[model samples]
Every structure is written in C-alpha cells, then in structure tokens.
Target: MHNEPLAYRMRPRTIDEVVGQKDVIGPSTALYKMIKSGHVPSMLLYGDPGIGKTSIAHAIAGTSNLPFIALNATTSGKKDVESVVTEARMTGKVLLFLDEIHRFNKLQQDALLPHVESGSIVLIGATTENPFHDVNPAIRSRCGEIKQLKRLTQDDIIELLEKALSDEKRGLGREKIRITKEQVARIAEGTNGDARKALTMLESIVIASDEEDGEYLVDDAIIEQMIKRVGVFGDKRGSHFFNLLSALQKSVRGSDVNAAMYYLAHLLENGDLTAVTRRLLVMAYEDIGLANPAVGGHVLAACQSADRLGLPEARIPLAQAVAEMCLSEKSNSAYRAIDAATAAINKGQVGDIPAHLRDTHYAGSAELGHGGYKYPHDTPIGSFGGWADQDYLPKELKKAEFYKPVVAGEEKKFAGIYEKLKDFRKK
Candidate 1:
C-alpha cells in the first residue's frame, strides 16, 4: 500500500474520510443512514471521472463490515461474477464493487442479478457513463437509488489535499516538503474539481521537485507546469455531452446570447463539432421558425461550412450562428403548430381527404367521386390574392385550426394574411 500511487493510497478507508458528494453520502442522506445500519443495498453510482465514485464504494465496504470483492466490467465476465458469487456463498454476504459497470453486457448483468436479488452479494456498481442511458434495465431495476456523485468543490479538493499532506502512512507527511496555500489552491482549481487528479498532481510535483538540504519546495512554476500537462476529460459519449447540448439550445431559445455562447464553448472544447452544428440547425427551425425564417437558411449554410471546415475553424461559423439565434426574434408558433397537428393524427383524428383534394389522375378516380377539384390559379376570386376559396383540408377537419401564427418578425405579416384567408373561406 505504501508503494501504491498517492491517489490509490489516499482513498478513504471509512465513510468519515470520504470527501465531497454530499448529495449522496451526506450524513443526513438515506444512503448514509443505510450504511450506518450495516445493511447496504445494491446501488449504482455515476458521475464524471475522478469524482469519488470508487472512493464512496471503498467507504461503503469499510462501514458495511461485509466481505468486499472487486471486479471491472471491462475485464470481468460471467465467470468472474460466478467466482464472486461462489465466494459470497461461503462468506454469507460479500460487498461486490463493480467498476465501469456501464460496459457490462446484458448477459453479464443478468447473471449477476439473481445473486444481487438474493442478498448474497451486496452490489455497489460505479460508472462514468449514465446508468439511465447505458446500463441494462434488469440491473437498473434491481438497484436502489442511482446515486449521482458530483465534481468535488474547490474546498473539497483542498480539504482532501490537506488530509493527504498530513497523513504519514498513506500520504507524504514525513517528507520535508513545502507547499503554500496559494500553490495548493492552484492545484485544487486546476484539477477541475477532481480530487484524485489534485492528489496525483501534488504527488508528482513533490517527487519531481529538486531537493535542497532534503527539503522539497513546490512553487507556482512547478504547479503550472504540472497543471498544463493535465488533460480535460471531454466526455462526448456521456450524459454530460447531451446536457450541454440541451443547455445550449435552451439558452438560445431564451434569447440569452452569453449563456448560449458559454454552452457552445463547452461543446467546442469537447471537439464535437457535428453535435454543435446539428443542434444549431435544429434550433433555427424549432425555436426561430417563421419569426425569423431567414435564420433557418443562415444556420444551414453555417452548419455546412462548419462541417467542411471542422474544429478550430468550425467554431467561428458555429459561434456566429449561435449568436444570431440568440438575437433573433424568438417564436415557436410553427414548431408548436406542427406538433399539435401530429398529435391529432397520432390520436386517430385523421380524416379522409375531400373528393375535390383527392388524386384524379387515376383512370377509376372519376367513378369514385374524385373530381370537381377547383383550380385556384385559373378560377381566381376578385382580389383575395387571386385565389379560389375552397376547403383544402379533409371535410371532417375543414374547421380544424392547426397553424396558429404568432405576431413575430415575418410571421406577423403571415398572421394577418392567415386571418384574411379564414374570413374568405367563410364566404
């Protein structure tokens, strides 16, 4: 254990030592109460990487006083689960901490279900991917509340670092190392709320620093050098990615340019140009719609240019599109209208087309009452836009009003024309 990496060695051995994730493991939380009672339920923990999912599991194992065994879904299979189950039978109950549980295939998850159900194995699964979207339902249904561990706050990271720095057994306390509060704070913020990353970086800086008279001093220069080497874990295939997209769209819809740009930056940072472009195009039509009809075309052109350019260059066009959308006259009249029409159809509100609107090109159409279609172009009315007022909708839905236009941008003019047409139809 002394030879292990600082992050691994510093993992909390008891619930009292676990940091952050107050939402799930806080003293007043149901999970905390359960652990204290010594009867732990099978649960799944999910969040971003390095956010104490495994640490929480370790804490649970320590408090539960049950046999603890570990397996990773990526490498462990049905046989590995069976091995655990076999041990569980001998021990009467084993706390099985399955890491990366999202990668467990359906068959593998199903095999573990019965043992979990029988309480022989108190399962605690940890995943970076969202269990709601990635985990098998059989396993999901059997687990208790799917706990979401959040990124540790800067203070939480600082507390963990302080604890590790003072612990002689698992941490680097005995060594005559010197680090300032600001330097430690830099590590906390630079790690992006990852406690493991903070601890590992501190360990690296201490080991790599030059020793003078057996005392290692860490400064801003060394800290910045190490911080620059840390990679931001951009999760393009997880729930965080989708959440960012949703946030971007909603911000644009609310006409908040700054908020929209903020989310766009996150997506760009993640390197998902396709998602950014595609979502922007959808927002143009879905939110801007007839209010600023030209925006749809502009967004499409921008998206096309973005797809061709890709990356760093793509961000320019994407940013321009997002900004334009935020400033545009917002309206969802067309979007809501189409959705309302679709809902009616979905509920069996559809009706047969009137004979005048039915296809008449077929030879037998004349015999089936498919004729009498008035030509609006030729049989024009006086000044009602050179139109013949006729029921285009099916007879059963002739009075159904789906396209309720809004008074916004170009749609405002369209709404006036719509009212005139309705009056004309009455005659």
Candidate 2:
C-alpha cells in the first residue's frame, strides 16, 4: 500500500504543472489569478473522471500553505464536516477539499456551510456530476463560484505521460525503460482524454514489457495488445457506456466513417443492443431527417432485425446501417424546424388553430364557421392532393415559416417544392 500507483505519484503539485483545462487554470482566469495570490475561495470543480479534480484541489491547498483537510464525501458525514469546522477555528485557516461532493446529503453540506461562510475553511468541492443539478443548493450558493474542467486533449495526455515516464521522484524514470512518442500518443488516445487511465495503462505496459538483455523494450506487439484490451476489457454497462454511445452518434452525424466504426465496435463489444439501436434510431431522425426521411424507415427495420437476430449476427446489419448513415448526405431541417416552432410556442408567439383547420364534428363547430373549411382532395393545389393556399395556420402566425430545407439527400426535391409554394401562399 505504501507503493502508490504511477497516477497517484504523478499528481501535479501546483497549477503550473496541471495540463489542459486552460479555460480554468490559464493565467488570465480568476482561479489562476487567485491561486497565484494565495487568496482562493470556495469553489466547486465538476467534469469528467480522471481530469485532475483532486490535483487542482491539492494545488489550491498547497498554494494556501495552510492546514488542508481532504475528505471523500461518500464516507464523510456530518461528524467529519463538524470536525473540519472545529479544527478550522483552531488552525486559523484551513482548506477543506471534498471529493464527490454531490454524495454529501443536504444535512452534511449544511454542516460545513457556516465554516465556509465564516472564511475559516475555504471549501473546494469536486464531482463528476453537473453541479447545478446535483450539488446541494445551499452549498452551491456559498461555494462563490464553480469551475468546469474539460477533458485532457491528446497532446495534454501525451505530455503528462512523458513526464510520468521521465520523472524520478514521482514517475517511472528509475525503471530505465525507453518509450517512443508514438507509443505515448497511442496510450493517450486509447484512454479517451483520461490522464489517470492513460498513466495507469502506461504503467501496465511498462510492467508487461520484456527485459531484453537488460534493456526493457516495449514493441508494437505490446502496444497492440494494450489497444485491444483497452477497447473491450471493461464493464459493458459502466458509466463510460454513455460516452461510447455519444461517440458513435456524433461520428455518424459528422460523416466520419472510421470514427463511426470505431465507436460501433465498442458499443457492439459491450453487447448493448437496445442502447445502440435506440441512439442510432435517434441519430437517423434528428440528424439525417428531412434530408432523407426514407432512411429513417431503414434504420427502424435494421433495429428490429438486430433485436430478433441477437449479437454476433446482429452486428452485421448494424454495421451496414452505420456505414450508410455515415455516407448519407446530412441535414437537420426537421430538427431545426421543430425546435424553431417549439421556441415560438414557448415564447407565447403562438395563436389558436385556424378555424378552417379545426374539427367540425363538434355540435357547435359547424355553426361557428368551421363548415367553410375547404377539403384538400376536393380542391387540388400542390403536386399532392392537398390544399396549399388555405390558411392552415392561425392568422397571427400566417407568415411564420419554420422549415427551410437544405440541398442534401432527398430534401433537394422537397426544398424545390417548398420554395416554389411558400412565397405564393404568403401573398
């Protein structure tokens, strides 16, 4: 237990050594300025895992050069909160760094509120959940400010890995192993912007490499093995499941065939058929909608087919659908159009439905001018047997046009028809 993991040993001691999240730790930011002046206040740091929430807290505590108490909110209750408060009063100044602060119940949070407000304990709370939705409101109110941490980029991860590989006191420098830039980058890429995961992976790779004639050599085989294991050797339904699903959706929507397949493999390997099918269906409609609504039917068919077929065989149709979606011309016309109309309704820009479009079957509806409605089949207007010139929208919103089709996929033809008719209807 005394021998700490490389990630723990390599934790940044100061803000200057912290990589990435320049938005929060950059010289120009309020947190950075305060850290420099050693006048930090209560703050809540929330973001993805392994993105240095603890490192930042430690740096703040180290900078203050005051008594620092680090506690995990998962295990620490009101007793611990009161203990910290009591000690802060005696210690003059104390930095109380709480990990997984969202785990602290309302009572636990309230117990620490007074010390924070009294300037005895500068509270630094960290959690992976969104602070606004999960953190106790009272604690948040007194936290003064919140700092959002971002995922470490490939370059950032590589730099941190390099430091870990070379640092003697805090890294693997004493191991006498040599590593290439490409290997470090590969390790960084595998973990998906998680510094701790990347470092742990590097340490594993180092331990696994062979000592060839006293020279520990990490070759391509070791790297390839690590890659394959990292992609598939995790809990399928873990928190990272959403991350994989999101990656696949975005990859297909962005038309990146390679990335789409990469994430698809992760999703399929996890055997989460329902989750993948649901998100793919959403992407087909929300992203590929209007442009090619017919593809929406195809996605539905594929999902249904996969559900019946089950895994190993189910992935084939899913892969085919993913490829098609990646290659499909993209458009979000339906998404944009609906959102615009919804925004209007939300803002009170809507009016009652036009009388002509209202139902006439009710007792008084026919007598209330609903009988004047023109049947679209009886009066042919557009290419379809529909009445385009009739006032379907209420008078107040007669000129409100929500959809503007893009010239992509099947929408080009729809756009031509809409463009030709919308202008004449407004007159």
lDDT (0 to 1) per candidate: 0.87, 0.84
TM-score of each prediction:
0.93, 0.79
Give lDDT tens digits, candidate 2, residues 59-89.
Answer: 7666668788999999987898889988988
Which candidate comes out best when scored by lDDT? Answer: 1
Residue pairs with colliding backbones in model 2 are none
Q: lDDT value for candidate 1?
A: 0.87
Q: Which residue ranges in model 1 land beyond 4 Å of their true spot?
A: 362-364, 379-384
> Number of clashes in model 2?
0
Alpha carbon RMSD to native, model 1: 2.2
lDDT of 1 at 95: 93
Per model, state how many residue pairs clash: 0, 0
